[model samples]
Target: MRKIKAQLFISLDGVVEAPDQWHFPYFNDEMGAAVDATLGQADTLLLGRRTYDSFAGAWPGREAAGGEDAPFAKVLGDARKIVVSNRRLDFTWRNSEQADGGPAEAAAALRAEPDTGAPVWISGSVSVVRHLLAAGLLDELNLLVHPIAVRKGMRLFEEADASVPLELLSCETFRTGVLNLFYAPAAGPGAGTYEDAKTHLPQH
Candidate 1:
């Protein structure tokens, strides 16, 4: 089976949108290596529409530009990309295709196919991640939690989203103070309710 992994760069307060405004300052070699390692495990990328458009505008010709960022740009440019969106998009990138149905349906079909021994990575797609997580199709979620509190952007999980219990797989802290958190879906509703934990509380 092809493993599905979702990765995001999120702030301490849970903001995930527009990372460019505050993200690069904490970037370092360690973060680069962590990202590289994640990409190295996958040949296919699952992207949300906005991210796809941004990448479509950003990565196409960087390889030939021969800069320090060329190698990573090349990797993204050549990887098989699947965009999840109902809206029509102009796919100008190579090896890119729009998903046939909803996120869950698309993921189910992908996983049901012959195991290619390669993982499908969900990159910068918050909506896709949420959908897949809700559908129980995501095998793993990797979050690089930055220490800053970005007071204004869409968070990874919002007030309208349902509760999800996650199992922590591993966690590492980079020198730049970024937290690399890997999590898998837990089976049940979670530890329990406040009422259930009442026994552990001290008497007033």
Candidate 2:
């Protein structure tokens, strides 16, 4: 099966909303380069309805204008995108498709694709992430935790029936106080540490 890699920009308080507000200011050249490098590893993109609307609105135009000439716009225009949305509408972007069902269905459809050896990147999809987590469809998670805390905003992880354990594969802190953390599901029962316990550790 192909791996599903979920990446997010979250605040210290676990807020993942609108990172452009508090997080973008700290995005230095090194961080930009790193993000570009990370994007290069994936050829598939997955997104929730809200996030899909946001990205579809911005990227298609920017990509057409060849604006920024950055890795994000470039790859976004080229990669295959699967947007999960119940809303009735057709996908306008080339190489993009609208998934009419929920996360589990979308994940299953994605897994059924022919082996491409490229990862499917889930970006800015908290609801989709939660559903995939519950369905055991997520293979890996890469969270970029910014230092600032927002008093009120959307959260990265909300309460579920029970806690799902994940093993910390690696972590690192950038000079801008952004911490990059990677995680995968625990191999067995009682096989993983809490997220809070690994907060201060440097990335591997």
Candidate 3:
């Protein structure tokens, strides 16, 4: 079996979409190192269509950039990437595949399949992450919470079909004031649906 983990770049107010518009300022060598470490643990990527397009557009060239992120770019380019989309897409990038089946079922099937020990990673795929949560297929959730609140953008939890409970696994603060929060689905008392988790979120 494979472990599915998600990593998100989010704001204080929980916005996860379009981080490119506001997330760069807080990035630094420390943050880049942290991200590199996370990527090192995964050999497979499970992505939604938009995330796939965004990465396919960017990382290919980075692999030859010979910089701190070059290794990560190489790994990303070499890893087996599975994109979930209803419509067919041209995968101009290497090692990429398309899975159009319903998100939850397809992800579940993928989980049951064999693979290398490295985990399956999901980053910046809000819809895919939501379906993974709904299907209880996610083994870990990592949120890099920046200090600024963008005031407007798509949120990570806005349209989830059910509120899922997550138990804290770890929390670390960076010099840039970014909070790295790690979690797993709740298992003990207080374990409940995502609705149960909403009470803990900031109001819009």
Maximum-TM-score candidate: 1
- Model 1 gets an lDDT of 0.89
Per-residue alpha-carbon lDDT of model 2 for 48-133, expressed as tens digits? 87888888888778767865754467688788888888776677778888875888898988877787888788888898998898
Candidate 3: Cα lDDT at 1: 87
Off by over 4 Å in 1: 189-204
TM-score of 3: 0.87
**Which runs in model 2 stand beyond 4 Å of their true positions?**
187-204
In model 1, which residue pairs have backbone atoms overlapping below 3 Å? none
Please identify which of the two predictions, 1 or 3, would achieve the higher TM-score against the true structure: 1
Task: Between candidates 2 and 3, name the one with more favorable TM-score.
Answer: 3
Estimate the lDDT of model 2: 0.81
List runs of model 3 lying over 4 Å from the truth.
65-68, 159-161, 187-204
Ten-residue segment with the worst summed lDDT in candidate 3?
156-165
Residue lDDT tens for model 1, 1-204 = 788998899999999999999999999999999989987556789888998998888888776688988888888888989898998777888989999888898898788877788778988889999989998999999999999999998999867646888999999999999999999999776467888889899999
Candidates sorted on lDDT, descending: 1, 3, 2
Q: Write one digit per residue (lDDT tens) for candidate 3, span 1-204.
A: 878888999999999989999889999877887787777556788999999999998899787777867777889998888999989878989999987596787678778888667788888989999878877888999999999999998898875445778999999898999998999998547547889889999999
- TM-score per candidate, in order? 0.92, 0.86, 0.87
